[model samples]
Target chain A: MIDSIARPTAAIRARPVLGAASVVALFVALWMALIWSPPDAAMGNVVRILYVHVANAWLAYLAFVVVFLASIAYLWTKRPAFDAIAVASAEIGVLFTGLTLVLGSIWAKPTWGVWWSWEPRVVTTAVMFAMYVGYLLLRNLSNDLERRATRAAVLGIVLVVDVPIVHLSVTWMNALHQLPTVLRPDLSPTLDPRMLASLVAMTIAFTIVYAYLMTARVDIERRRQARIIEARA
Target chain B: MTIARIWRIAAREALAERGHPDGFVAAITFVATLILVESLAVGPLAAGQPPVAAALFWIAMAFAAILATTRSFDRELEDDAIDAILALPGGRDALYGGKVVALTALLALVALVGGLLSGVLLSLAIALPGHLALVLVAGVLGLPPVIVLFVTLALRLRARGALVPILALPVLVPQLVAATNGTAAAIVGDATGALGWTGLLIAFALVYSVLGLTIVPTALE
Candidate 1:
């Protein structure tokens, strides 16, 4: 059973296609964002950062949703494939989350005049980053694959559930304190057609990149599992 | 029968704690030390302010809860008694419930002692003691389910001591935020605000309690 399950599948065979498509999409997205998009009326060129930042943020969220679903599947079926998917998505989720934070910080320094803020979105994202980092750390605490997968899945579910509450608490905390709004510029800029096109293009590009990364990561996880099983056998 | 079993397990834990009070002692000491150290770091004038004191109080509670939960689970692991406990009918959920009950009671005591100490040491003049007590209770109640769940999940793993906090603390952020703000509001006589935050605390506790119950069985296996 282990031997049969470890055999490479069509999904692995298609990796190059995914990789090529992601590269092409990203180039198109870069062009659209850097040159095709119109500058914002209020913030001008600084608005370009949102194309990448928002895409990263969106993909980070998508990755966690995958983790959540894959975790549930892993728990229900006890399949190594599902576990691999969960862990792969979780790793990518953390990477994108970190990117989101750095990009957010860069965007904030110029816009909010501070590198960080206790604003609801910022605080919530930071907390989530820590939580998923913990998730990744938890994955390494067990030597047994099944044990590690079970524990990671459990934590993954818990962390995802906590996201909304974390967001709510931060928002309410800010609401009560009513931090100085003068520094926070209007985030919802009127999106011109070109700007919308760029944002959409970047989002699509990031999603493809996510797919390419996942395929490679899940392949690595499966190979690692197969090697472990081979050693035991 | 389930409730009785849960109570039995909790009572057993209480008796064990009465006999060996080390966990409770360590937790209290941790709370005291954290509060004192934070107060010193913040300086005398700033530490005495209501908001600062409230934040320090909850921060201490959060760490104290971690210490208490770790020690609680450590006992089960040391005796290798988890398998035996799980062998009993309906033991998994009961054990979780029992631990939550036992730990919540233990933490309530810690909160009482720590709260009074912070009140005096920080020179906080509480306008509403009852509301502040309610916040403390709700906040403490919000803690054990997550701690017990995560600690149990990480119980037999390597690097557990470090892993447990890293796993548990981030989940506890919302509760910590709500509790700290609630404490501040209660101290400053903002009854409505305190109640609002307390509501959030209760919601958090309920959510995690349900989640822990559903997940603990698989986690134990």
Candidate 2:
């Protein structure tokens, strides 16, 4: 039985503020990226894609970190809220991971002269994407709520353990092959100030978007649970 | 005493396999066909082509390991035996340990058969028998825990056959790479270099073993 956890009946009131804030931040980020950031000396305006691509990649990682932590919290506390947060973060994580791959591909076409490369980071990122998708599929296979949460939590823990190992092995494999690193090796020293500023702004803006989506998604889950409990009673 | 009990459970599993032998039979049949198909694809191996042959052998061995794991763990789910075992004192630990031992042995057998089959069918000579065996042994040690955990995880699903490989293979990437590379190194008579990858295989084995022991109980529940 789910205990009636205290929640604001008018939780929708805060969403508009968060939503508007994210919207404003996102617009400012785009303006800064397109207008304020100077053209790249090396690649000209094409480098602007980094503002969107890198920020999305950061948000994807942040989402999975949320999934990982929320999974742990769910397992520890056995609370429905934690499970809601975990699944919400996972859904957002998958969406952003897909976006990151597409944006990276777009960036790669101009920079690397190909739409895709089996670079270590790219390969590991793809693998991670598939693994979390598997996590979602595994969760779907179970019908019971508690059973689903428990099993998904176990899989989440297992998947996170492999992330570091995959990163290490792929890095070593790429080093052995001596392939050119995809990300710039001279990033900090070579980066233009305006570009860095826009990138930083985009990062913050994307983070706010992620947080707002997560909260909104979890709130929806909370209402759904409450309705189910009310019906049962 | 726990170690002894773990061994006894492992021995029971081996004995059970000997009596029924369905999983072993299926794994061997699958490996045989896999090698035959791979041999056709790669075509007459040129001299000093152990890497290609090693890659084929590892792939076949991996599939065979997956098949054997599904059979082994699915049998536990039958007759509600897993529930009974979980009720025993320290049963989860013992069961995990026992399954690891049994699976390691089973996968090692498949690897041996696979390695020899590739050597013969593909005309790939094993220049360093001892070193190649060591690499196979080391890699197979790491293969089973992950496979067993995945097979157990897939038990609750309808698409057990398809889900096991999807969930397990990505995790096995490191072990697969290490095994293939180590086998190639051995075939080139580089015992010292092969040992480096063997050490890597051992590390994977240790990590997966600990992970299985700690998590399998919760997974089983």
Output the number of the lDDT-best candidate: 1
When only the first chain is scored, the TM-scores of the models are 0.89, 0.85
lDDT of 1 by residue, A38-148 (tens): 887878899899899889978888899899999899899998998999999999999999999999899888777889877777777888999999888888767788888
Pairs of residues at least 3 apart in sequence or in different chains that clash in candidate 1: none
Question: Which pairs of residues have clashing backbones in candidate 2?
Answer: none
For candidate 1, write residues B1-221 as lDDT tens digits: 77888898899889889999998999999999999999999996898888889889888888888898889878887988778889999899889999999999999999999998997888888998899988999999999998999888887888988888888887888899899999999999999999999999999999999999898878887
Candidate 2 per-residue lDDT over residues B1-221, each given as its tens digit: 56776797789889989999988889988988987887776676542287877777778788888998788877877857778777888887788788889888877777777677777777666678899889989988978888888877777678878878888888887788889899999998998889999999999999888888887777666
lDDT of 1 at B112: 94
What is the two-chain DockQ of model 2? 0.64
Q: What is the Cα-based lDDT of residue A170 in candidate 2?
A: 49
**Residue B103 error, candidate 1, Å:** 0.2
Best by DockQ: 1
- Give per-residue CA lDDT, model 2, range A1-233, as digits (tens): 44454274354457777799899999999999999999988889998998898788778778888888888888788887888788888889889988988998998888888898887767777888888888888877876667778777777878886455434554466432223223344544346677778988999999989878877888887776667556666
